[model samples]
Target: MPDLVIALDVGGSSVKSGVVQADHTVYQRRTTPIDSSGPAESILATLAAIIDGHARTLGKDAVLRGVGLGFPGPFDYAQGVCYIHGVAKYEALYGLHMDAELRARLAWGPKPPIRFRNDAEAAIIGEFCYGAGRSFVRGIGVTLGTGFGSTFVVEGKPQRAGPGVPPNGWLYAESWQGQQADDVFSARGLQARLAAAFGRPLDIPTAAQRARVGDQQLQEVFRRFGADLGAFLYPYARAFDAHVVLILGGIAHAMDLFETAVAQALRLPVRGGALGPDAALLGAAELFFA
Candidate 1:
């Protein structure tokens, strides 16, 4: 196995890339927010620059095995195609052959293979391999960030999209509380809910801060978030027969506010992400080994 690989976790808000060792140590990590509103060519150019810059920094002596990428869906991983049309973000990637575009811009000796998977799937794989899900044979991973990301894994492999898993193995579009899960479980959802309840604009951090200070309204928001999360995952947990459900990403930091509700709603074990955001990058790299 190669000692190092370039890994990228592409989210709706930002793209995180790094050179990661087999043991999960990261080097030369870089993160930048993506402009989903920008022109498609510009987005592609930004991605190209990052990949080229990383490859150059790794130097000619670096023996990189391949590049592994975890990106949002819906996408065609086999053909390196993106289908993010009408989504909240990354819509410019729609119908683009992203893998070829990146590879064309990467100037490295002996072009390496590039593997792609849904960001949620990669995150879960990372969790199973090195985080809270490590001990469980059946696990479900959810990343509550710009959007809801989800995947089911069993015995170290991700389950394909099916009856229980939903389309493209994504939980974001799942129906919940008479609306889509994406409408209730994402960063936008949190902010929107806060605005409606408090009659003002409130970002996630401010809401969390207020909750910490015993602000009842803010506290209720998080509690509702927790309750909704629990309600959303209840069926999935039953379907996957999950031993543990790992919650990850920016929203996870407020677990103290909503942990009780989530725990009560979930029958199985539930925990915050042990590896945090790095889990997806690490998991993306693992694809090379697999």
Candidate 2:
């Protein structure tokens, strides 16, 4: 019988789940929209349904191995408890013991082990194990999207403290130029710069499109963002003696727009993630495999 694990990347607005084989290939995958702000029970029910659906798809002889999740913070990944509040998402889950709730709802013959990891950490782990960071011994992964997410990895394991890593290995709370790194490096940051430049707010996708079409002003905005990102990462990269940096998330799609500036400033190899959204799911599965 084949052994398969269910892996999930839980986000504020959606959940990406997959059935992964021992070889790290996803046999089946799904992305489900979630109203994270909804009632806790409703959200839990949705998650249960997703899991049950995947379980039903397995062949009769397949053995369920475990369930793994990549969730955002402030969460207790080790305990499967949620402390996320005031984030406009997953508020109803505050103080909830997710592992117990999930276990109670599963219909499998024997409950599978359930584990969780920080979403950013999971992404980096996926990269380290299977994607762009596969060749490096130590590196940093940055996910630039609705917010700035970061993690440090050594030998395929996520590290929270050491030389060059900020408290909790997170850069979002760190200050750069009197502003939180999240405020300066996220999608909102790009929009803020674009708004300041054109006297109106412009979304990242629109800005990228314009920049690609020879909109010099928009192009400059991305370049400046890249330069600033590089400047911010320089100290940490040097401190950690990082060998490489892997960029992930929606913003990474536009890396070409700013790759030059980041490379020039950081003076290190910067590469985009090769796994796309699957990185987190694969990384989540690693909680059990590792």
Candidate 3:
């Protein structure tokens, strides 16, 4: 029988889950809201139901070893306890026994082997085995979403860092987001810039178009965005000595226009993420497969 594992990446807005073979090739994937208002028990129950729905399709004979989970916030990998939970502005999980209920509802067997990992760290594991971080001993991934986030791989495994810094990786410094990075570079930052500069909301393609056509203001805006990220990311690059740094997200995807400014500002070399949206899904697989 082909061995199978169910994995879920719990994020602030949504939960990304999938089933993968032992080799970590994803066979199925799904996403849903991270509903937390209905008590942690309800959350776990829904999660189990979600997993079971996928499990039935994998077949009963498929040797479904267990489900691996990635939760945002601080976690005690050894103790399986939720510590300082703050992924999406939710406070219900602060002292919750996230693992216990996850096991009870999500892992349903006498010998169930549910494994949990830090969200960002798990991303690194997935990237290493099934995504872009494969060859580099030092792999770093930044999730540039509502916030700038990151994770690292050292010696072919997740290297943990942080109890703070708003979840952005590579550069956790307040300067990266709350202060400068996002304040001047992210999607929201760009929106504000356009509203201020053009007196309206403008998309990237349009902004890039204008910039390419020699629109000085638009060009400078994107340039400043890159420069800020570069400056914020340089210290971490130097500290971790990572050869490949991946920038993942809508903002990071458009690296061509802003990358130079960011690189020049930080005086470091960072590249676009190799995996795209698959990083989180693959990271879910790493929970059990790794």
Candidate number with greatest lDDT: 2
Error of 3 at 116 (Å): 2.5
Q: What value of lDDT does candidate 2 attain over all alpha carbons?
A: 0.90
TM, every model: 0.89, 0.97, 0.79
Best to worst by lDDT, what's the order? Answer: 2, 1, 3
Misplaced by over 4 Å in model 1 are: 12-14, 32-36, 59-62, 87-89, 161-163
Provide the overall lDDT of each model, using Cα atoms, as 2-decimal numbers. Answer: 0.82, 0.90, 0.67
Q: Which is superior by lDDT, 1 or 3? A: 1
Residues 176-229, candidate 3: write the lDDT tens digits: 445655455456777677668877889876887888788999888878767766
Candidate ordering by TM-score (highest first): 2, 1, 3
State the lDDT of candidate 1 residue by residue for 161-266, as single tens digits: 6546776567887788788888889899888999999998988988899899999988998998898898789888887678888888788888899888887898
Better of 2 and 3 by lDDT: 2
Shift in Å, residue 183, candidate 1: 0.7
The true-versus-predicted C-alpha distance at residue 218 of model 3, in Å, is 2.4
Clashes of each: 0, 0, 6
Clashes of 3: 6
lDDT per residue as tens, model 2, 158-182: 8889999998899999999999999
Q: Residue 23 deviation, candidate 1, in Å?
A: 2.8
